[model samples]
Target: MAVVLLLLKTVGVLGFISLLIFYLKKIRLYRAAAKFPGPPALPFIGNAHVFVGSTEDILNKIMELLDTYPSPLRFWLGSRLFFGVCEAEQLKIVFTSPKTIEKEDLYKFARPWLGTGLFTAPASKWRVHRKLILPTFNPRILESFVEVFAQQSEIMVRQMKVEIDGDEFDVFNYISLCTLDIICETAMGVTMKAQTEGDPTYVESAKRTFEIFYTRMFKVWLHPDIIFNNTRLGKDQRECIDYLHGLTNDVIKKKKLELTFDSPIIEDTKPRKAFLDLLMELSNEGKKFTDEELREEVDTMMIAGNDTTASVNSFVMLMLANFPEVQEKCYQELCTIYGANINTDTVITHEDLHRMEYLERTIKETLRLFPVGPVLVRYVSEDLDIGGHVLPRGSSVVIGILKMHRSEKYWKEPLKFDPDRFLPEEVAKRHAYCFVPFSAGPRNCIGVRYAMMAMKTLLATVLRHYILKKDRTVRIEDIKLKADVMLKPVEPISVKIERRKH
Candidate 1:
């Protein structure tokens, strides 16, 4: 009886000590985070409640917070504290800092789907991988892809032609499928035919995977592997991941059998090497990227290359539809480039893409309003000073691109969609990091040139053939946005496309 009593007392003492340590750590974090302005946080839970809502509601709440708080604001998600910065000066320190290159814990949600690909890998591994992949996106490589872009764009134009019966439809669906086909052909050397086909398993799996990851991010209860795996959402996530992996593996296997290392093939005479072929060549040489590494990169490129460009294309189309004047200007620019003979069959060369300067600006302005990734999150590796606040190590820093883009200080008539904001004179006056659609810094999107080529090619082709008009008049303020892995509109962007009178 005495021994039992002593054991109970010992257990109680240890538990008390553990509780004390936890509270002490919390106190320390609170003191450091106290320096920044933010919404009041509760003990233990912090500001986690703010994140509990539908994706659209969560986005609205975040926008509200951005309006209320100053730059370098602090917020806690359970015990973890995050610093949110939306000003250009503050962003410069975050993006350009060599030490702050690591992505935040929030990116871990993508691990199951992407593995440790370029997007989610550590700074050290990212450097090596980035060096190897840089050549894959060179101007020559991207120039070769113009044909693929033009071909796929023609397919998209044909598809749109079938729908141009003076009726409105969600433009995102067609555009997303077209991008899926483009990425598959250029990145994997496989034609998914997603544009012609209703919906392929690979495309569906990718979409489901992103949606699952987005859900896991905001819902704290769904974070732990043991608990999540047991749930229906978790099971769905695993199946989708497996399906995507299987599809990529099949593509990789087929490509390996066809490529030969010894052959010194001429660039023009031989077929153009896909991005996967380039990666395989690196592996064939002494600088070997393992099969797993290859898979990660291929998967990353497939997902990243498809969805982001698709979102931008859809948004740009929507913008053009809503503003007829802007659409007319873009059409005029296209007319100058192609002359009166411009048709759906027009082949868009690299030189032709550059001449659509106004259209490029419009794409930039669209990105400013609706950045594909609304927020860029990084893991603070070392103690840093941002906007006079001494941010301690081991905290997450979120750069709110949406907030920064629309901030009154950096933009004139920030809410209005003005392509002139990117004009030479206007651009020169603004901070270099102020307009980062593809992000800025050493880790900025490696696919920037490829995406631009694709967007310019596709948009130029579509505008040449049709006049896009909104089906229903919708104001920018009325359109609701959702905070997923990517920024998405709650309602589909429906537009009416009319055949141009040649």
Candidate 2:
């Protein structure tokens, strides 16, 4: 009896010590976070309750918080500290600082799919892979992709003819499928025919996988691996990932086989290289990238390349549809380049893409207002000062790209969709960090030039062939947005297209 009592006392003492240590650490974090402004948080739970809602509701709540709180604002997700940094100056420090190079913890959810590809790789691994991949996206290499972009775009245009002179339909699906085809052809050297095939397993699996990732991110219950593994969502995600990984593996294997057999051929007579072709070449020579590494990087390229560009292109089309005047201007610019031959189906060349100064500005403006990455989350490795406030080390910093883009302090009528905001004189007036659609700093998107070229080529092709129209008068405020892996509308972005008159 005495021994039993002693054992119970011993267990109680250890438990007490553990509790005390946890509280002490918590107190330190609480004190550091107390310096910033935010909504009053509940103990233990902090502001976690606010995140439990539909994706659209979650986005609305975030926008509300952005409006209420000043820049360098604080909030907590369970025990983790988060600071919403929206001011351009504050964003500059968070982005450019060497100490803050790592992505936040939530990015780990993507590791299952991306597998430490450039998007989710550790800072050290990212540095090496980034250097290795940089040469593949050279301007000359990307210029070669214009033919594929224009070809895939023509397919999308032809498919949309079914909707011409008919009632409005969602244009986002058509744009996404077109982008998927482009990415598959350019990134994997495989013609996905996503537009022609109409929702293949690969495309469907990828779409569901992104939704699953975003769902897991906000739902705290799904954070634990053991619990999530037992759930239906987790099972579905696993199947999707397995299929995706298998597809990438098959592609890599086929390319390796082709390279092995084709080594005797001369370079000039060979086919134009895809990103995967370039990567495989490096892998074959000097044993650079492993089989796994190749898969990771290619999967990253497929998702990153297809999704962001598709979202921006869809929104740009929606914008043009809503604003007829802007559509007219864009069409006029295309006319000048194509020489008033509206019906002519000429392939968009790299030289032709550069002449699209006005269209480029329009795309930039769309990015500013509805950036596909509405928020960028980075980790603070050490105590970091943003403006005057110090973010405690290990805290997650959520850079509110949406808020920064629309801040009244920086933009004139911030919500207004004015492509003129990107005019040379107007651009020179604003802080560079205020308008980061591609993000900024050492980790800015590597695919910026590639994406711009693809979007311009695709948009130029479509505008040349059709006139965009919308059923209802639209405003920026009218579009209800949802926060997912990407920023998208709650409802489909619908528009009508008419065959352009010659």
Candidate 3:
């Protein structure tokens, strides 16, 4: 009986201490941020709890929460304070000063999967790596990848033939494999077995990596002490990253041998035409690039180049399936433009993409409605004067990118998936900072042109050959975005396809 009494007393004391700690955290952190409009936070956890469902909806909720609380909205995530930056003026202040006003620590949690790649590295290294690799991504050579883009896209079209008989099709896996193949070929100079021969091992690893990443980011600790100490990555996440890098490194080594050839792309004397080969050339005869630097740049490119493009494709496939009229329009345009020669060997030039304005608009509209990366973040490196106030050092300044895409100030019908809104003349009227499918300021996505070309080419080819119709059970909002590396539908983007009219 005495022991039972002692145990009850211990429980009471623990509860009291928890309350006391909550009080101190509120007073020290949130009260200090009370100047900003925001929802009241619980002791340790903040808005992090609301991220349990579809990726886009979770971002929509974040946008709603910010709208409810306006600019400089403050909240907590496990005793840590975070601010949701809404005002355009404040976004400029933060994005333009990535060297000072912010860093990319949001990716710290992603390190187990991506190492110190461009997204995870510090400003100094990122700059060096950026400058060194910038030339390889030059728009001039971007035309070269068009054929590569067309090839893999045709492969996807061939695969879709089996499901084109009014049967439901899950596009999430197909689009991922397509982009994975493209990136593996173009970025690493090697084609993944998954895309070429229908192997599922690489595909499974990639999906599991993303799942574990999400779990680590949101799962509440079993106890308090577990939160404060260094939280190491799960074994699976580490293995996934290792396998990805090992595959890339092998490809880079193989591509280096052909750099001695005069022309990287010629009729008879074959040379490596991939971006990885380009990086190898710069690494060998360079003032700045070393072996390690070369690997890091390739690593960054490989990781960034694959998932985001795939996510965009996955999103558009779902949208096209749901909107039959829009899908028909796109299909008709493809017939007029590319005719019937859309296959794995299709070699489209950059100029060809420019002619497909309707195609571009469809891709742009998809990005506005369902951005592959919904939120863009930065950590304040120094004191930043934003909007009306100054942010202290070490503070994080986050932009609701998906919110801005839907901001009423920028669109006539913000929620509608109307591609016509992006007409050349109409595009000029929108705010320069708004509509950031790839983000903006100096840190705007460098792969913007490449991503656009790749996506448009694939979409045009698909529309040319097949008519996409959504499964009756799927709604636009019903497609949950379960994302880790990049945004993807939580459920498969199931659609029925029919061979298009010639």
Candidate 4:
């Protein structure tokens, strides 16, 4: 009895001490965060309730917070301090700082699917992998991908004829599959033919995984592994990840067999070397990446490269449809580059892509209004100052890309969809960081050039074949957006297309 009582007393004392230390840390965090403006937080929850509704509701709440608070707005997610920085100057500080290179803890939710691929890898791993993969996106190499982009885009344009002259239909489904096909061919040196074959299992699994990840990101209860593993969503995520991994592994296996020690270089005769093939050549040259690492990168390319491009192209299509005059201008630009008879079969060369300056501006404008990545989360490794405010070390920062893009302070008549906003004169007048759909800094997206090239080629192809249209009644303001693995419309991006009457 004496021994049991003594153990209980010790345990009780330790628990008290732990709680005391936890509160002390929390109090300090509160003091540090109190310097910035944000919504009042409740104990323990700490503004978590703000993220508790449907993804659309959560987006609205976030936007509401951005509207109410000033730049470098402070908010807490549980005990973690999050500063929402939307102003260009503040964004520049967070993005360019070496201390903020690491991604925030929230990205861990994607690790089960993405592994430690470039998307979810730690700063140390990311630095090395990014360097290795950087050469693969060389302009010369990306130029070779023009053929693949044109071919896949032609397929997408042909596939969409079914929607011709019909009521508005969701274009994302078609666009996503097309991008999946393009990424698979370019990333893995294999053809997925996702568009021609309807939806593949890998495609379905990946989509489901993204949805699950978005759900887990906001639901705090799903953060713990033990608890999450026991739930249905967790089980579903496991199944999806397994399928995705299997597909990537199979591709890697076949490529490894084909790549022998004798021929370290893939023949120039091949239309183009896939990103995977380049990595394999490097591995063959002795800078070896494990089979698992190869899978991580290929999967990352598939998910990151495919989804963002698809979303941007889809949104651009919708925007073009809504503003017929903008669509006509883009078509006119395409005509100037590809000639008046530009049709579904027209091939877009790399030079042609560069010449479509107006189309490029339209794409940029769409990205500004509806960037696929609405927010980028970074971990502050050291104390940082922005706009006379201190963001303490160990806390996180949310670079509010969406809010910043739409902020009236940076953009005049911000809500208007004016491609002219990207004209050289206007762009030069604004701060450099004012528009960052691909993020900025040392850790900025490695695939920016690749993504832009793919988007331009795809858009040029589609526009050549069809005139995109949308209900003028459907204003941009009515488009409800949701936070997924990417930012997407709550409802599908519905638009109508008609065979171009030349």
Candidate 5:
């Protein structure tokens, strides 16, 4: 009885100490976050309760908060504090600041699927990898991929021919397949045949992986690996990641074999080197990347190269379908550029892509409405001042790109879908950081030029062949937005397609 009483007393003392540590940490967070305006946070839990619901609902809540709160607001997720910045001035500071370059802790969730690739790697590693890969995207090299983009787009145009029967269909899925095909060929130097073959094992696994990862991001209970790895979601995530890694590994092995036996002179004759070929060359020259590192980068490129361009292309088509005048303007521009060749089997030259100014504006406007990354998150390594608010070290800051793009202060008629908003004169008038579909500053998207080439090629090619028409029932406002790393329309974007008479 005396021993039992002693054990109980020890337990009581430990509990008291635990409570003391919790409150001490809370006090520190409260002191740092107190200066900023935010929703009231309860003890221990903070504002975690505010994040309940489906991903769509959660995004809506965030948008509402953006509308209600002033810039540089504090958001507490349990005991962790995150500063949300939406205004251009604040975003400039966050994006350009050297100290805030590391990705937020939330990105660790992707490590299982993407590995420590460029997206998930530390700033130091990312800087080195980024430099090594930069040469692969030089203008001359990108120009070589034009043929790949054109070929893939031609296949897409052919596929759309069967669907042009006055029935509306989801355009995003088809475009996604085409983009996947492009990435597979350009990044891995393999033909996935995603559009022609339907959903392959790798494609399906990737889709599931992303869906599960997004789900885990909201369900905090699953954040612990011990708990998550035992659940069905965890099991599925592991399986999907294995398949994805296997696919990338296979591609790497095949490329390495080709490099070993193939003659360098023959390789030199090729029109353009694939991204893998460049990496292999670097490896052969002693600037090596481990097999694991190569896999990580391949996965990163596959994800980055496919989704962002596909989303933009799909959104652009939706916009063109809804806005007939804008569509007509784009068609006219194509008519002028392609002229007699508009309806002919003509190749799109690099110069032709350069001449697509108006179509470029439409793409920019679509991005403003739905930037691929709705929020750009970064880890604050040191205490910093942002728009008059102090963000303590170890905190995370999220630049609300979607909010800033649509904010009334920067955009006139913020909700209106007007392509001319990106005209050179108009763009010059606005804050430079106000519209960053590809993000900005030192760590900006390395594939911006590549993405633009792919998007412009697909869009211009499609417009040349078909007239895009919106589903009669779908309105601009009816399309709900959801954030799953990338922002996407909740409902499939269905459009009626008609063959254009040359």
Candidate 6:
């Protein structure tokens, strides 16, 4: 009886002490946050509850706050208070100003997958990888990949073969499938054939990865027990992540085995132009990227290059379907440059790609409406001040990209879908960094040029063959979204397409 009574007393005492500590922390946070602008947060939970389910809502909150709050809105996540940085002038401070915001914890989630690569690697490793892999983005590689992209794009055109009076069929899947194949073909020297094959391994894994990605980001809201135990998101995420690891391991194993017998791997066997081949060649020379290192880049390329870019292309088609006049302009632009005889056999060259300026503007507008990476996060390594607020070290600051895009000061009719805003003169008038679909600074997407070329080539090849119209089922505004890693349409985006009889 005495032992049981003692145990109960001990439990009560521990609970009391924890409560005391929590209250003390909250008092200190309240005092620290008095100088900044934000909604009052409760003791332990913080403001994570304000924006749930969709990051679009979080983006909306950030947007509302951006116009009202100064550049930095001091907010809390548990006991830690962070100053969210938004203004373009301040972006230079955080991204370029080496001393203040030296570390990036935004991509910490990716560390498990893409360890110490250009994306999230430490300063020293980043320098080495950045320099060594610099040649991958060279003109030679870009040119070679363009040829590969054009070839795959032509194959895409050949795959679509149905005719009807002006009508719409689901083409988002088609574009996604093509890009999926293109990335693999160019990067891995493997053909996915996702368009022709109904259930391709790579494409399925890519889609599943997005779902898993959303779960990882979204589950931050629920109570720890709810999130980890007896939840669909948590359970399924493990399987998907495991599958991704398995795929990368398989690819790495294949590459290593090929390297043993063949000098260039591609030269002795297939002569295929692949990122793996280039990395292997460099490894053979002197710079050997370990299996894990190569896996990091390969996984990054798969997710970054495939999922987000495809989502934008899907939205672009949806926009084109809505505005036939814009589609007409894009078509006319292509016809003027490529001429009347363009068909499945047409090989789109790198120089020819530069001429399609109208298509480029349309894509820019699409990116504006549905920015793939809406929020950019950075970790403060030291105390910093910007736009009248002081941010301490280890604060996870998020830049609201979507809100900035739609800000009244920078954009007129911020919600409207207008391609003319991106005209050479108009674009020049705006701040250079205002339009950042690929982000900025040292961590900006390296595949921006590759994505643009692929988007243009495929748009040229596909739109030329079909008249695209929006399906009645999926409207422009109402198309639901799962806002997590990359914002994606919740349902399969459908567009009706009729073959253009020449």
| lDDT leader | 2
Best by TM-score: 5
Give the residue spans of candidate 5 off by over 4 A.
none
TM-score of each model, in listed order: 0.96, 0.96, 0.84, 0.95, 0.97, 0.88
Model 4: colliding residue pairs: none
Clashes of 5: 0
lDDT of 2 by residue, 1-502 (tens): 9999999999999999988898797787789988889999987678888888777777777778888988778888878888888899889998899878998889999899999999888899999999999999998899889999999999999999899899999887899899999999999998877898897677678878888888777677778899988999899999999999998999888887887677555644656888998998898787899999999999999988888888889999999999999989999998888895656877789999999999999999999889988888899999988767889898988888988888889999988989998999998998989988878999989999999999999999999999999988788988888877778888888899999987
Clashing pairs in 2: none
Residue 61 Cα positional deviation in candidate 6, in Å, after optimal superposition: 5.2
Residue-level lDDT of model 4, residues 355-401, one tens digit each, is 98999999999999999789778999999887688899889998889
| Candidate 1 error regions (>4 Å) | 1-11, 260-268
Deviation in Å, model 6, residue 69 alpha carbon: 4.6
Task: Estimate, for each residue in 1-502, the C-alpha lDDT of model 6 and write its tens digit.
Answer: 9999999999999999999987775664466578777777775667656655454465456556666677778766555566666677777666665544334443554565566667677676776877887788777778878877777777766766653554555665666778888887777777667767855566666566555554444334533545554667556556666787787788678877877866644565664458877876777788668878888877777777777767888888888878888999998887887686654456788898889898999999989767887776777666667645666655657777776776677889877789999999999898877778788887678888888988888788777787788645343456555555676666666677777668
Q: Sort by lDDT, best first: what order?
A: 2, 4, 5, 1, 6, 3
Ranking the candidates on TM-score from highest down gives 5, 2, 1, 4, 6, 3
Give one digit per residue, the lDDT tens place, for model 3 in 293-391.
566667667656777787788778777887788787876675566666543344666777887887778888999878866776677666677867666
Q: Which residue pairs in model 6 clash with each other? A: 168-495, 168-496, 168-497, 169-495, 169-496, 169-497, 170-495
Judged by whole-model lDDT over C-alpha atoms, candidate 4 comes out at 0.87
Deviation in Å, model 4, residue 194 alpha carbon: 1.2
- Of 5 and 6, the candidate ahead on lDDT is 5
